[model samples]
Target: MTATLMTGTDLAAEMVAKAADRARALQERTGVQPCLATVLVGDDPASATYVRMKQNRSKKAGIGSRSVVLPAETTTEDLVAELTKLSEDPAVHGILLQHPVPAQIDERAAFEAIDPAKDVDGVTTRSFGAMAFGEPGFRSATPGGIMRLLEAYDVPIAGAHAVVIGRSPILGKPVGMLLLASNATVTYTHSRTTDLPAIVRTADIVVAAVGRANFLQGDWLKPGAVVVDAGYNEGNVGDVDFAAAAEVASLITPVPGGVGPMTIALLLEQAVDAAEAQTA
Candidate 1:
């Protein structure tokens, strides 16, 4: 059977449209709109582009967004103060601090400043614990999108062996946690893992988030395995070698069109949900 290409952009657009309808209905009855606050440090081109795309999508979905852009020289204490201020703002329903803050800034401290209820980006330790425990809390956007994609396509998670290649707090670890929540046995690998290809070959579901270009080869995938490529390297290439994996796998997510758009979509969705909860 030919591999099914999972287009996250298409799915994300559909989700945003549906969420827009919900937002409108909620606003009509409650006279309240969902709002997201995005904080950015430094001037990384890719981060800036991502933040802009999220803001644009939020607008399209009838959600409000406020952006706080800080300079490269911004101190860690100053960043934490800013995030704390946003967390306390009644008008801000959701808070997202873009990753890769300047080297001098303590990113973890900044993330911890966000209130769990408003941590729609799911970066805080509280959010992580909630996800691990399968509690009622916002999920990391990319992981949430991955699970949504799987459910949308009816990919079985229960009783499956899923191998996640990466261990970053935002993407790799969180995605594995989500899969585990869905009853999938999870094995997490990273750059230091030996026999990486062998580990991937044993997985019924493979998630590549190692940030290395074309790291997962076609021959390494189990035939008919489901592959989700969450890595986006320079020039928009993903971690898995898509052409190769597609030839062997049953289902796969592409680089630019796969997991990227869905991240922003889920962020907007959670932002709307947070807003509704605040107004309720």
Candidate 2:
């Protein structure tokens, strides 16, 4: 049987529209506009484009966005200072430090600079702790988006065996935690994992986030497994080979049109939530 398509593009559009209305209502209720501050260092073209896309989406959602661009040589101390300023700004409701900052900078330090209340992207140590413990807090945008998509499609999570590849701080680790919180038995694997295919084949749900071009093949999937490809590599390829996976998976998400749209939409939605919470 051909796999059912789980397209995030249409879902994200619907989410953004609701977020826009929430933003408008928050501003009307408290005279406080939702504002997101995006920080980027070292002018990576892809990172710049991502930041710009977020800013554009924020505007369309009726939320305000501020961008902080730093030179490639920016020091860790300086980057932290910049993020700190945004964190303390009462008007700024959310803080997002674009990942892969300059090599010399301490990315973790910069991420920690944002206050927990404004950590809408959910990249802070505090946010991770909250997720691990199943506490209420902002979730990392990508993982949160994946969960939303799963819920929207009514993919059964409770008691399902979920195999999550990759162990990155925000993406893999937290996503696995989220699935576990939803009662899915989670098995997290990485590059060093031996017999990766064997592990993946046992999963009823799969989240491919290895960050390589078509690294996870389609045939490794268990027939009728629900697949979420969270990887977007060069040439518009995802971690899982979409063509091959679609033929086998009971449900599959496509590259570019899948997880990509959901990330920004969730970010905007969380920003509105932060604004409303902070004002209250």
Candidate 3:
């Protein structure tokens, strides 16, 4: 069956509109605006574009945004200090540090510096713990967006055999946990896995987040499986070979128009949520 596409662009637009209303209501009631602060270390063009997209979306949603661009040679301590400052600022409701920081910088340390209360992008230890424990807390934007897209498409998550490829803390690990919380049998695979294709062929839901281009082939998918490609590689290729996978899978999320828009949508939603919680 040619897979029915799960388009994130449409859903993201709806979610963003709701976030805008929420932002307006919060501003009207408490006179406090929801604000997100993005910290960028180094001058990575892709990261810069991602940050700009977020900022532009925030403006449309009525969420204020501030950017802190640091040199590529920034130290971990300096980056952490900047994030901490944003955490402590009453005006800032959320903090996001663009990923793939300089080699010398400790990314996790910088992530931890964002206060749990303002961790709208949800990259901190606290947020992960909350997600793992199924507690009420923010989620990393991309994974959260992936889950929302699945639900929006009415995919049956419970009891599904889900194979999540990759082990990244923010993407694969957390997405697996979220799926487990939804009652899916989750298996996480990495580069070291023996015969990865064999494992993927058994899954009813496949989440490809391994950061490689066309790593998962269409032949690996179980017929009628639900495919979610979360990879954003250079040249706009995803971990899964979308053209091939779509030919077999019953449902699939396309690259660029799939997970990307939903990510910013959730971030804006969480920023508004954080602001409302802070004011309440």
Candidate 4:
């Protein structure tokens, strides 16, 4: 039997359109459009493209976007000052600082400057804590999107063994917490994990977010497993080898067509949510 490919792009587009309608209604009701402030430092081509894509999608979703482009030589303090300003601006509902800001800039310091209420990207430590403890607050966008995808597909999560590879605070770790919140038994593994394939073989569900190009192998997947590939590596490749994994797993997400689009869609949707929350 051919495994079902769960590409999120089409689904995400549908979600964005639905969200846009809601955002427009909210704007009409309150005369306040939800705005996201996206901060980019230096001229990394990939980062530039990602930010542009986000802004375009946001506008299409009836959400407003503000961009800040800092010089390559910008200091951490300079970045923090801008974030602080955005945080204090009631008109800006969410702030997203694209990763790999610069070696000279302290990324965490910049993330912490975003007010929790406006932390739509869910990179702030405050949001991290809330997610870890299962408290109510904004969640990391990509992780939240993954959950939304699962729900949209009607995947059963409760009592499932969810094995998550990678442990980064923004993406991987937050995803594990969310799986746990859904009552899944979660196991996190990283580079140092011994016999990684053996561990992955036990998972009923798997989430690959290690940012490596086709790192997870197909043979490692349990037959009938539900797979979520969160890696957006160079050339639009994913952590799990989609061609191979699809043959093994019951449901698998493609690299370019899977988690990537959903992430940005969720970001814009959350930005609108944050704006409405602020206005209310």
Candidate 5:
């Protein structure tokens, strides 16, 4: 049986519409538009495009956008200082630091500079801990989006065996934690994982977040396993071999339209939530 596609475009749009309504209401009540501050370092074309896309979506959601572009040679201290300033800004409800800042900057250090209250992208250590403990707090945007997508499609999560093919702090690790919180048994694998395909075959659900294009083959999937491709490599290719995996898996998410849109939608929605909480 051919796999049914789990398209996130429509769901993301619905979520964005709801966020826009909330943003409007918040503005009406407080005279303050929910704002999202984005920090970008260097001139990576791909990162620039992602930042632009987020800013544009924020506008559509009735959220104000503050863009901070730092030089490629910026030191870690400077970046931290900038993040701290944004964190303390009462008008800014959410702060997102585009990933892969630069080789020179201490990425984790900069992430820590963002106040947990304004960490809408959920990169801070506190946010990660909160998510791990299933406590109330902002989730890492992409993982949060992935959970929403799974729920929207009515995919059974609890008690399922989920193999996550990455261990990145933001995407892979957190997604696995979320699945565990949903009662799914989680196995995390990284580049060092031996017999990766064999592990994948045992999963009821497979999340490909290794950042490699077409890294997971179709033969690796169980006949009815659900696939969520969270990788967006060069040329829009995903971690899974989409065409091949679709022939075997029961459900799959495509690149570009799957996790990407949902991520931005959740970021905007969380920004609105932060605004309301801070004001209240």
Candidate 6:
């Protein structure tokens, strides 16, 4: 049977509309417009595009946007100092640091400098820990989006075997933790994983988070497995061979319209939540 597509575009739009309503209400009650601060370092064209898109979306949702662009050679200390300033800003409710900052900057240290309460993008260590333990806190945007997609589509998560094909701290590891919290058995694999295809075949759900394009083959999936492609490589390609996997899997997510929109939606929603909490 051909797989049914799990399109996230419509669902993401619905979520954004709701967030806009909340943002409007918050502003009316407290005269505090929810605002999201985005930090970008260097001139990576792709990263810049992502930041611009997020900022545009935030404006449409009634959330204010602050753009902070840093030079490529910026040192770790300077980055930390800037983030600390945003964290202390009462007007800024959420802070997001575009990933893959300059190599010289300590990415983890910069992430730590973001206060946990304002970590709307959920890159800080405290956010990660809270998510892993199923505590109430902001979730890494993409993983949080993935879980929302699964729930919206009524994908059975509990008691299922989920194989996450990557080990990146933000995407792969955290998604696995979320699945585990949902009662799904999780197996994490990375580039070093041997017999990768065999492991994937055993999963009831497969999450393709590895950054490579078309890295997962159709033959690697079980006949009815659900596929969630979280990779957006060059040329809008995904980690899974979409055409091939669709022929075997029961459900699949497309690269651009799938996980990407949901991620931005969740980030904006969490930003509104942060604004309400901080004001209350």
Clashes per model (N, Cα, C within 3 A): 0, 0, 0, 0, 0, 0
Q: How close is candidate 6 to the true structure, as a TM-score?
A: 0.99
Q: Candidate 3 at residue 121, lDDT? A: 83
lDDT of 5 by residue, 1-280 (tens): 4999998999999999999999999899989999999999999999999999999999988999999999999999999999999999998899999989899999999999999999999888899999999999999999999999999989999999999999988999999999999999999999899999999999999999999999999999999999999999999899999999999999999898999999999999999999999999
TM-scores, all candidates, are: 0.97, 0.98, 0.99, 0.97, 0.99, 0.99
Across 157-267, the per-residue lDDT of candidate 3 in tens digits comes to 999999999989899999998999999999999989999999999999999999999989999999999999999999998888999999999999999899989999999
Error of 1 at 160 (Å): 0.7
**Per-residue lDDT of 1-280 in model 1, one digit per residue for the tens?**
3689888888898888888988898789888888889999999999999888888888989988999999989999999999999989998899989998999988889989999999999898888888899999999999999999888879999999999999999899899999999999999999899999899889999999889999899999999999999999998899988888998999999888888888888988888888888888
Selected candidate, larger lDDT, 4 vs 6: 6
Instruction: List, residue by residue over 77-179, the lDDT tens digit for candidate 2.
Output: 9998988899888989999999978788888888999999999999999998888889999999999999999999999999999999999998999999999
Query: Candidate 2 regions off by >4 Å?
Result: none
The regions of model 3 sitting more than 4 angstroms off are: none
Superposed Cα RMSD, model 1: 1.1
Model 5: CA > 4 A from native: none
Off by over 4 Å in 6: none
1 versus 3: better TM-score goes to: 3
Model 4 RMSD in Å is 1.1
Candidate 6 residue 199 C-alpha distance from true site, Å = 0.5
lDDT to native, each model: 0.90, 0.93, 0.93, 0.90, 0.95, 0.96
List the pairs of residues colliding in candidate 1.
none
| Top candidate, metric lDDT | 6
Give the alpha carbon lDDT tens digit for every residue of 1-280 in model 4.
3578888988899889988988899889988888999999999999999899899999888888999999999998988999999999887899999987889888899899999999999998899889889997888999998998888888899999999999998999999999999999999999999999999999999999999999999999989999999998888788988888888999888888888888888888888788888899
